[model samples]
Target: MANDPIQQFEISKILPLEALGTDISFTNSSLFMVLTVGVSAAFLIMTTSGRGLIPSRLQSISEMCYEFVADLLRSSAGSEGMKFFPLVFSLFVFILMANLFGMFPYFFTVTSHIIVTAALALLVIGLVLVYGFWKNGFGFLKLFVPSGVPAVLIPLIVLIEVMSFISRPISLSVRLFANVLAGHITLKVFAGFIPMLSKLGFVGVVGALLPLGFTVALTALEFLVAFLQAYVFAILTCMYLNDAIHPSH
Candidate 1:
């Protein structure tokens, strides 16, 4: 089981619960999600609790994260979009923490699962739809209608725009899930080689060096992908929200 890459993703029930006919068991995925939220909240709270003339390392990190998400929202959605800072910031931190936690041995990667990522993507898209309609009413439909197009081509353009809009959740969720899933699987494959080669002979032990080197490099790359995926998800959310805020454009 230790050598099985797919085994790491298996969700085991921690506390089984059922309501009527539905199974609502707490799972490994659930545990990690709760941990991610708690850790993210604690980090932000601890870092910002104390205000001083000179910032501490934790304070600096928290501030930088705040500014980073704020800047992303500002650039993508404009100053008006700062209203959604809490939502965007929370998503960014939760995903970033979940991805980083998965790097540790035996830790479950929540974002690697399509169910988790899809839920998040749907939440963002749902908000966009709800707020878009509430803010713009029927004008929200204008998002599918471009500002300038020949009358003959308007119908085809609207159809394409509608399809693209509908695909946001799938693309957003798959991008994060696929990258994390593939990276972890590749790391596990190389890691498994290290022990297998060492078991062969002295020459085999020396040959293990190549896999070890690749594993190290891949681990570093996964860390960057972790941060980048979170940023991409958050920024894309902002862009979608911008459309909701200004559908005509």
Candidate 2:
């Protein structure tokens, strides 16, 4: 059990409870998610509460994150997309915090689960669908119809476009889920090797150092991946919202 890499991802009940014959027990994942939200909110609030002209480190970080998402929204969806800044920023920070929190020992990675990622993906897609229709009416269907296409190929292109649009949530959720799940599994497997190698003779001690160094490097890389994944998720959301704002193409 000690060497089982997959065991770390297991969700065990911390406080069991039942409601209407359904299990609503709190688990490690729930705990970490709550922690993620609380910590993220507190950090932003506390850092910016002073409203200083000359920014401190934490204040700079808050301002940078604000500008980053704002610029990303503008670039992807144009000035009109700034209206959705709150939604996009919230998701970016939440996912970023969740991913970073999971990097710590014994912490549950909420984004690693398909259920969580899928829920988030569905929320974005659902909003896109609702707003697309509400804002553009039946004209939203034009999103699947490309301009200047050959008459004969229009039907085929529409079918492909429809399929691609429907697959967005699946692809988005799976991308994050797979990356976090695989990364943690790989890190755990390599980590398991260090103790095993150290138990051997002199050669084993030297061998252990190799895995230790590699593990450290991988951890750093994972941090980069964590941030990138969050950015990708947020940017993709902006692009999808763009389709809602301008469905002509």
What lDDT does candidate 1 reach at residue 99? 100
Candidate 1 residue lDDT tens string, 1-249: 689989889999999999999989999999999999999899899888997558899999999999999999999999989999999999999999999999998999999899989999999999999999999999999999998789999999999999999999999999999999999999999999999999999999999999999999999999999999999999999999999999996
Model 2 per-residue lDDT tens digits across residues 83-103: 999999999999999999999
Worst 10 residues of 2 by lDDT: 1-10
Judge candidate 1 at residue 132 and give its lDDT: 97
After the best TM-score superposition of candidate 1, give how far the Cα of residue 205 lies from its true spot, in angstroms: 1.0
Q: What would the TM-score be for candidate 2 when compared with the true structure? A: 0.97
lDDT of 1: 0.95
